[model samples]
Target chain A: SQQGEEDPQALSIQEGENATMNCSYKTSINNLQWYRQNSGRGLVHLILIRSNEREKHSGRLRVTLDTSKKSSSLLITASRAADTASYFCARSPSGNTPLVFGKGTRLSVIA
Target chain B: DVKVTQSSRYLVKRTGEKVFLECVQDMDHENMFWYRQDPGLGLRLIYFSYDVKMKEKGDIPEGYSVSREKKERFSLILESASTNQTSMYLCASSLLGGTNEKLFFGSGTQLSVL
Candidate 1:
């Protein structure tokens, strides 16, 4: 079963606009990571926020984790056409367990 | 550069036929995984191996099996292919014992079951 559930199944925005995606999981996690997948391709790791860390940033990507609410959010600033892809959030329950991925959010950045 | 290579970019197999998808990672990572990507379902783990000759079933392992005879190689087998099993298969590898280690993924294999 999937541990995380991503909100806003699809999002459309202009190239210069910002995009936000949210994820909610059932159980506690050691960390949360976000990934992006282009059409017909594999996933690429974006950023990871540990349970202890409230927020993290990589380039224009920002990730925030809230353990109390068991949820996380990803924000992509200044979206571009190349940024159009499916974004997923994965949760690791512990160091020994494999990461469980959410369904994902499809983001379309119009040029 | 870290690389995970899938043997095939595209494949077509008839229903009930046996199919094998191979993956090799050059990073010498201790963990390997097989996942299937569908249109609306995102990615679902099929199987994973933490070490050579060790395997574990994931959430959707039915009708599928895996083999990991070597540390850097993982093979996903479809015992009997079905139309419903047609999807994009991805292979990934990661180091062990890290709470937030990033996974390196292959380009993916698009399999079609007729």
Candidate 2:
């Protein structure tokens, strides 16, 4: 039940354009994390945003958390063909629980 | 970098066969998890262990079991493999009880149940 929904199940963008994905949860969370998975590969941790923090940035990635709306968004700046991958948002509901992930947003960066 | 290694990158087994997927972490993480990823369904946690000999059921743990007899090793066992059980299995480890800690995942094993 702690699982969230990722908006825009799939997206297509140009190589130099930006891409954004959203995740909305049904319950309060301690922290939210974004992960990227290449085709047929395991996920790579991108960034983590705590409930108290409104925004966090790491290199080309920016993550924003809106606790009031129980939603979070991940934005990738200047996407590349290599950036074509599925992105998932995971939430740690409580200290004792493991992270629950969303279905993921599949992004296609055309070169 | 933390290394969580799943024993096999790909596995094939017949229905009703006993299967064991092994995972080892070199980072001395206190928590380990087993998850199966499926299309449209995302990643579903099957089991997790916080300590040696300690196991907890996740969202979908019916057909899978796990063991953590050693601090660095975690294993997922399938009593009898089924066709529906065919999926990519991911192993991950993280620090002890910290919401801020990030999970490091293995390359994953794609299991094919015939």
Candidate 3:
């Protein structure tokens, strides 16, 4: 079974607008990371928020984690056409186990 | 800068042919992983190595095998390629045993099994 499931599987937005994607997980996690993938390419690390941290920011990207709800949300502000890509949320379990990822939210930012 | 490289950017092979996908990381990370990405399926971990010559099976390791001869390289092998195996294969490496360690990914190899 998939540990994390992202909502709004596909989203379309105009450039310069803000896009928010949500992710819900089933188990407790030590940390959660977000990654971005361009078409036909590998994933690029975005940001990571640990269970102890409630929110984090990097550039135009903001990430929030609520351990009580086992959920997280990523907000990309002032989205650009270059931001059009698939974003994935991956969870790392409490130990040395590998990270598990959600299907992802495909965001399209039209110019 | 950390760098991870795959053996090929694209490959085509016939059914029943043995295939090998190689991954090398220049960052000296101890953990290496192999994942297959498909449309709507995200990324599925096929195999992972925590150290040289040590391997573990992941969720979708049914028809795949892995070899980690050294710390910097991990190889994924398909015993016999099948048409269904066509997909983008990605390799990643991370530091050993850090809760917040981030994965460094390769550009990926788009394998087409005919």
Candidate 4:
């Protein structure tokens, strides 16, 4: 079974608008990572948040993790048409375990 | 820069025929993984290797096997291809023993079984 479930399976917004996607997991994790995939290509690592950390930022990307709720959210501010892609949330139970990815949320930023 | 490469961009094989999907990583990472992506099912792990010649079964390993004879190369084998087994196969590698390390993925191989 997949450890994480991402909400809003799909989202669409205009350029310059903010986009947010949420993920909920089933068990304890050492860390959570987010990835972005363009059509017909490999996934690109976006950011990772450790269990002890509440939030992280990378450029226009912001991620928040709430261990108490076993959930995380990825926010992309001032979205652009080039930001259109599929976003996935992956969870690692521990340092030794491989990541288990959710189905993903598809975001389309219209120009 | 880390680069993971899958040998094929697309493959087609008939039912009952054996198939092989190869992946190679340039970063010499200690952990390598194989996953199959299906619509609505996400990416399901088929196998992984933490070291050369070592293999571990993952979430969905039926009808599939893996090999990692060298540190930089990993191979996934389908004993006998079936139509139901068709999907996009992805390969990834990550540094060992890092709690928050991110995986580097290959471009993926789309396999079709007739």
Candidate 5:
């Protein structure tokens, strides 16, 4: 069971700044997903980038996957104060199995 | 919209007591999972069920058991609650088939064992 490991345990930035979080996994994957959790709340799915895809965008969120490196990066552009949350990356392995999540990076967006 | 719901948002139980955490999904998802989130441990899978009366142990299945008697409902039972088991419990559901599908998570249950 391989799990995605996100870098930078915690990050803080001002409003309107861009925030980037990276994730790395050990094995082959079908897809990678990014989720955001507000304080004391369940995680909400943000975006998913397939293994073959290089980059994807949804609103202010952008995800890039590099299968060669087994790494993925999630970029939230023009971060808002409301964007303060814990962002996690999960990887779907090659088979029909559960997605494995990382410890996540706590992002604090200051106004 | 797909929704996964946990029966309780918070629970408090004494050590040695039996604890039951229930979850239900509105969508007829074929897969259901139970995960515990801790401060530094991230989200560790406790158990997963792909069908009724079917279950699979996950990374940290110790002291945890699951029942999936119904298609939409799954239960995580703590035979004997322990202090170390106090953590946020999350239930998630996903459609069957490709592994690339997204998972829908519940609001979560914060269980406190005294």
Candidate 6:
């Protein structure tokens, strides 16, 4: 069974709009990573947030971790048409364990 | 930059036929993984290897097997392909034993089983 589950399976917005996606996990994790997949293809790593950290930023990507709530969110600021893709959240339990992925949220940014 | 390459971009085979998906990494990373991606199901781990000749089953390992003859290569094999087995297969590699290790992935192979 998948340990992580993402909410809002799909989202659509204008190119300049901001998009946010949320994910919830069932277990404690060492880290949570976000990935982007274009047209249901291979995934590209976006950002990773450690369990102890409340938030992180990488370019236009921002990720927040609320361990007390077992939840996390990814916010893409000033979305671009190129940003249209599926986003997934993967959790690594403890250390050195394979990541467990959520179903994912598909974001479509219209230009 | 790390490069994880899959042998084919697409593959088609009849039911009950043997199928093999190959992955190679140029970064000399110690860990490699194979996963299948399906619509609404996300990516599910089929197998992974930490070193040469070492293999471990992931969440979904049924009807699947893996071979890691060398550290740079990992292969996923299906003894008999089934219609339900048709999906996008992805390969990834990362540094060994890091809590915050990020996975580098290949472009993926879309396999179709008739």
Model 1 off-target regions past 4 Å? B98-100
What is the CAPRI rating of model 1's predicted complex? Answer: medium
Badly placed stretches (over 4 Å) of model 6 are none
Least well predicted 10-residue stretch by lDDT in candidate 4 chain A: A91-100
Q: Give the DockQ (C-alpha) for candidate 4.
A: 0.69
Per-residue CA lDDT of candidate 6, range B1-114, in tens? 779999999999999999999999999899999999988788999998888999999999999999999889999999999999999999999986653588999999999999
In order, what DockQ does each candidate have? 0.63, 0.70, 0.69, 0.69, 0.78, 0.71
TM-score of chain B of each: 0.97, 0.96, 0.97, 0.96, 0.97, 0.96
Q: lDDT score, residue A27, model 6?
A: 87
Q: Provide the global lDDT of candidate 5 against the true structure.
A: 0.93
For model 2, fnat equals 0.61
lDDT of 3 by residue, A1-111 (tens): 465889899999999999999999988899999999998899999999998999999999999999999999999999999999999999998877899999999999999
TM-score of chain A of 4: 0.97
TM-score of chain A of each: 0.96, 0.97, 0.98, 0.97, 0.98, 0.95
Candidate 4 segments whose C-alpha is farther than 4 A from its true place: B98-100
Q: Candidate 2's error at B35, in angstroms?
A: 0.4
Q: For every model shown, what is its TM-score relative to the native structure? A: 0.96, 0.98, 0.97, 0.97, 0.98, 0.97
Alpha-carbon shift of residue A50 in model 5 (angstroms): 0.9
Maximum-DockQ candidate? 5
- Which lDDT tens digits does candidate 1 get at residues A1-111? 655999999999999999999999988888899999998888999988888999999999999999999999999999999999999999988657788889899999999
Question: Candidate 6 — which pairs collide?
Answer: none
Model 5 CAPRI rating: medium
Q: Which ten residues in a row have the lowest lDDT in candidate 2 chain A?
A: A92-101
In order, the Cα lDDT scores of the candidates are 0.92, 0.93, 0.93, 0.93, 0.93, 0.92
State the local distance difference test value for candidate 6.
Answer: 0.92
lDDT of 1 by residue, B5-63 (tens): 99999999999999999999999899999999887787888998888999999889999
